[model samples]
Target: MGQLFESVVMAVKAIFQNKTRAFLTMLGIIIGILSVSLMGTAISGIDQVFEKSIESMGQDVLYVEKFPWFMMNDDWWEYRNRPNIEEEYAQQILDRSSTIAFASPSSSRRADVKYGTQAVEAVEINGTTWQEAFITSVKLESGRFFSELEDRYGTRVAVIGYDIKKNLFPDEDPLGNYIMINGNKFRVIGVIAEQGKFLGLMSMDNIVTVPLKAMKSVFGRLRRISISVRPKEGYTVDQAKEELTFIMRGLRKLKPREADNFAINQQEAFRQQFSNIRFAISAVGLGITALSLIVGGIGIMNIMFVSVRERTKEIGIRKAVGAKKSIILFQFLSEAIIISLIGGIIGILITVALVGVVQKFFVAQLSFSLVLISLSVAVLTGIISGIVPANQAARLNPIDAIRYE
Candidate 1:
């Protein structure tokens, strides 16, 4: 312990002797740490956003659609030719499938909405049954979702999204107010809660929903629709999917040898797709980090060699005065570590400051684990880069080194 302390003191003195050189040597480490840490922060932010978006999407729900969310074979044209998912399949799934607890058929179209003089354009108008409220995780900010009776009656009542409420009824209570959609007067019954953005690209809250009956008349029954399905409380997604598939195949009247022309989409499939995205981002980050750290490590190694040469006479003098070879090695190693660690600390501080600005635009998170990772990498780089130069310094003969000057 005492020897290590003395070595650290020696290292500090040597660093101060040429402060500019020490700082310059630390530059590589600083940049390396900064690049890697920022990459981690960006990845973490993406993960956070993904998790939140997934939660809003409901973890257990399934979508019966004409096309899969991810086409494994890149055969999109094959799937495009498949028939549209019928809206009535939602009821069939609920009635025939033991695994299904709730099902809601929904369709969407972009249209303009107006409340008196205020207007919002390109708003998504959703048409679904009352059961949709049970399958989705979206919460109502005010009033309540339309009831089964309202859906049966094809009432003109609509539930507006948070953004629409803000845009069209900025000063007044949106409830009980009438909004014009496709030149049709619809009364606002509820406001969907704010759901932020979906995948950070589109706003989930920019929507208006009405009953499927009304939706057919407003958007036309000619358009195809998808059905949302939720599994029974204790049923696995696979079990639910199997039941759904069986019913859909039967409903489509597919012959024993004929392939069914439908897609069953679930959160798990979405997760797999997102995992691929994460892997892609990680690969890029790893490449950048590897390059930066390697350059930084090389820089440190070169500087340590120069340092060993400059301190040879001093090493010999200390050895002559009873300094062990281990002490000399420790001294150089500690110096490298300190420089690298200081650089890492500076990088972390920089990351912390930038995290706030990043969140304002998108999402960036600086976590404690990420800091630990940066520091560990910095320290590891120091140790690896310093070892050979430190060993060379330790192996020098006192008589030869003293005579070198």
Candidate 2:
């Protein structure tokens, strides 16, 4: 161990002696490691954000929809095949499912909201129940959410998003303020808590929700509705799913073996889908990183060969003085490893710093696993690249080498 440490120290000193040459030699490795680490960090951060978003949606609640969120095929063929998920069907499921706490059918429409001279355009107007705001974590920052009694009375009250509140009512309280949906007057009842932005594009805060009855009154017909249902506490998720499926199947009046019309989307499904995508991304990144390492290895091998040729007389003299072949081999190999490792360390630091800067601005998070993996790959590359040169140095003919010099 002591001998190995001494050899490593010597290798490091050699690296610093010709710093520019060493750095140039390690260019490929540095870029490769940096690319991989940065990609890994970004991927990890995105995965974390997705996970947090799903978790915030509540594990007990299932997001039932006709089409999966990440499905690639959104064309006519897929859409036609998908069963129509209507409000009536959602209600039937709610009535039949014994394991469910509350099931609410929701639908959205994007339209311009007018508040006297002020106007907010293309805002998502979500039509859902009072239970939706409570069960699906739609917290209010101020004012009051519409009650079940108000919903039953078909009240034209609106709950604005945090951004909407800021846009429409900057100076004053928005509650009980009258607003128009393309001309029809509605009262502002509540404002939602700030949910920031998703993917730096869509702001969750830039939405407004109204009761289902009010929406039907204003919009004049809703064919589809998303059902959000929470399983009762103390029940396993699978058990809840089974019960809900059974209830849905019964409500749809399908045969025991027949496929049901409604779909049950859960938090775990999103987790699995997102996790699979991330894994695929990581795999592609690893493959590319491997290719870069291979190229860098070739460069190392070429440089080591040149080094060995330049030091042929030294090798011969050392061998004449009883320096073993193993020691020579170890020295060359250690040099290669040192060069790659220095590059790797620098790459890891740069990537980590970049990730830190990104995390400061974004809600996502990057982790240390990226650095660990990149460093490991670099070390492995060094070992692989050094092997041939080390072996050649070890097997040098001392008499012939001395005669040539």
Candidate 3:
């Protein structure tokens, strides 16, 4: 321990003697560490964004649609030719399935929404039954969801999202007020809680939902509809999916050898797709980071060699004074390690600052694990890059080194 401390002090003195050169030598390491930290922060932010988006869909809900959510290489025409999933399937599933706790049919389109003089364009308008309140995890911020009777009678009662409420009724209570959609006036019965954005791509809170029958009456039955189903409290997601598939296949009258025309999608589909994309991003990012680190390691090795050459006479003097080769090796190695560690610390500080700025717009998280990993990489790089040069310095013949011109 005493020897190690002495070597560290010598390394520090050596670094202080050539501060500018040491900083220049560490430049490569700094850049490499910075790149890796930023990459990790971005990946973590994307994961957080994805998790938030997926939460809006609910973990237990299953979506039954005409087309699969994930289509890999399969011709679009194959899905295009498949039969459209009808809204009636929601009722059918509810009637036949014992595992399902709730089911609702949903359809959406973009239209201008108006309340008196205030208007918002291209707002998402959803058509769904009252059961949507149960199928989805969306909570009401104010007022109440439309009743079953309202849905059955095709009442023009509408439930608005947070953004819609903010834009249309920024100053007044939205409940009991009428909003215009496609030239038809509909009474607002409820306001959905703030849902934020979906994967930072689209606003989930800029929507208005009404009864399916009311939507068909106003917009016609031309738009495609999907069925959302949720399992009962005791049932598992897989069991629910199995039962739903059986019921859907029976409804479509598919033969034993024929594939079902409809697709059953769930949160796992999105999770799996996100995982694949995250894996690809991480793989590519790691490759680039590895290249940078390798370059940095090479730079360290080159600089260490130069350092050894310059200090050959000093090494000979220490050897002549009876210094052990191991001490000489440890001194050079400590210098290299200290330089890398300094670079790593600077990189971490920069990353933290960058993450702070990014968090205002995105969701970057600078985790402790990432910090530990980065510092460990920097230390390991130092040890590996310093080995050959340190050995060369240690093995130098005292007479030749002292006499070196």
Candidate 2 lDDT by residue in tens digits, 216-287: 898988756788887777777787788877776676679978765556888777778877878888888778
Angstrom error of the Cα, residue 143, model 1: value is: 1.0
lDDT per residue (tens digit) for residues 1-405 in model 1: 998998998888888898898888888788888888998998898998889888998888899989888895778878989988887788777888889999999888889998898889999999999999999898999988999999999898999999999999889999998999988999999999999998776899899999989877877763658899999999988889888889999999998898879989888887898999889888887887788778888888899999999888988998999989899899999888888888889888888888878888887889899999999999999999998999999999999998887
Off by over 4 Å in 3: 1-6, 16-24
Candidate of highest lDDT: 3
Compared with the true structure, model 2 gives a TM-score of 0.86
lDDT of 1: 0.89
Q: In model 2, which residue pairs have backbone atoms overlapping below 3 Å?
A: none
Which tens-of-lDDT digit does each residue in 253-285 have in candidate 3?
999999888899998988899999888878877
**CA shift of 258, model 3, Å:** 1.3
Candidate 3 least-lDDT 10 residues: 67-76
Model 3, residue 271: displacement in angstroms? 0.7
Residue pairs of candidate 1 with colliding backbone atoms = none
CA RMSD of all predictions: 2.0, 3.2, 2.0
Report backbone clashes per prediction: 0, 0, 0
TM-scores of all candidate predictions against the true structure: 0.94, 0.86, 0.94
lDDT of 3: 0.89
